[model samples]
Target: MKKSFTLAEVLITLGIIGVVAAMTLPSLIGNYKKIETVTMLKKAYSEISQALKMAEVDNEFMEEWNFTAFENPDERVHHFFDYYLKPYIGTLKVCEPLEVGCMSDKIQHLDGINERPHAAGKMSFITKSGYSVLFWIHGDGTGGHFIIDTNGPHRQPNTYGKDIFRFILTFKNSSNVYADTAGYSKGLKAFGAVDGVTREELTGGNVSHAGLKPNYGCKSGLMGLYCAALIIYDNWEMRNDYPR
Candidate 1:
């Protein structure tokens, strides 16, 4: 006789299934979110790179522009972004420098718990692609730096290396920059550094920042600035082996 299961048996079996799901569901969900973030990051990088190439075509020879010659740094920022970035990129709204709604009020580290106000003189705006960008020109013609919130400020966990990432506008040939060849400043590079974390091997494991920690992007007081390069080093995919 194909008898049906008793009530208690069915309840127990269902309870076991629930327990197993409880054990694994959160992790699976978290991993999916991480993958989503990675996708957004790669998309942001590609868009910005394409814009840069266009900017190069529009403004012939960045090597000749002398933004460094400007006295007031703000003027340099205005000129560079207006001419180079504003024209080529799609900015839906230009936040009045640090005006509210431009970006997240606080920038945090990747420790995943610490929350603090980012005390820095910066300016940002919203892009049509749904990213918040903090742009700064060193007032030198070599190009500047960009801090991007890949998912925009609307999303949570707005932590560095999570929703936020940093990149440089380098004129120098950044190819083959892996290992110690990160002579970023030796040539006409951009931002605070030329090469990113790919220089880990050659510099005795040093990123753009001194004594940088591995997989530590935007953490430890932004010491993890090279973390994106670290991700790219891992083939543009975040693996379980990557730092949390």
Candidate 2:
């Protein structure tokens, strides 16, 4: 006759397995989300950068456009999209600037500081690739900014420096390109990157709406503005030791 374990022993083994899973599952899932966000962010950056380059190849020099001539901010925004972006940006729906119907009002400054405490955003559009484009033109039309949401407007982690990121654009001497605004916004209060700690503080560990990282000096008040550059600085990957 084959020996069998007692019912109590079988239950004990199963219970132990459950305990282990309960302890480890959340961490595993958290890491998975981090990886997912980074992947999409990298893809989004590459796509937008390439698209900008293509647009530059086809359009009139930005300064020549005289975007600021329009007194209405909304019209300035619209002409930029229609003239430079919508052609190859693969737009899905072009909504009125800052309209809740397309973009979320979730802009923040990183150090736990919210730009619009109530989530008021400006003009933007939804792209076919599942990202929202917050495209802006300077009043003078010599420069602009591109703020993108990697996971669309409605997804969780919609916080800046998490899913929402910015790209600065300028036109000089008839050449247009993205400026180096990839890291933290210039002149914001920063506390992480002292020596061995940096991007991870903003992009690594768990993300909270408050913008504070546990056990890390990365306060989100000013970090959201420039954290996208962290991915660029990290060579397109969020290394395990980030924010250390």
CA RMSD of all predictions: 5.0, 7.4
Tens-digit lDDT track of model 1 for 10-55: 9999999999999999989979887887787777778777776677
On TM-score, the leading prediction is 1
| Residue 73 Cα positional deviation in candidate 1, in Å, after optimal superposition | 1.9
For residues 76-164, write the lDDT of model 2, one tens digit per residue: 87776777677877777777765664567756544555554222224677878788767666665555667778888788656666677
Candidate 2, residue 225: how far the Cα is off, in Å: 1.7
- The per-residue C-alpha lDDT of model 1 at residue 190 equals 18
Which regions in candidate 1 have their CA more than 4 angstroms from the true location?
A: 111-121, 173-182, 185-222
Angstrom error at residue 28, model 1: 1.2
Among all candidates shown, the one with the greatest lDDT: 1
Residue pairs of candidate 1 with colliding backbone atoms: 68-139, 179-202, 180-202, 180-203, 216-224, 217-224, 218-224
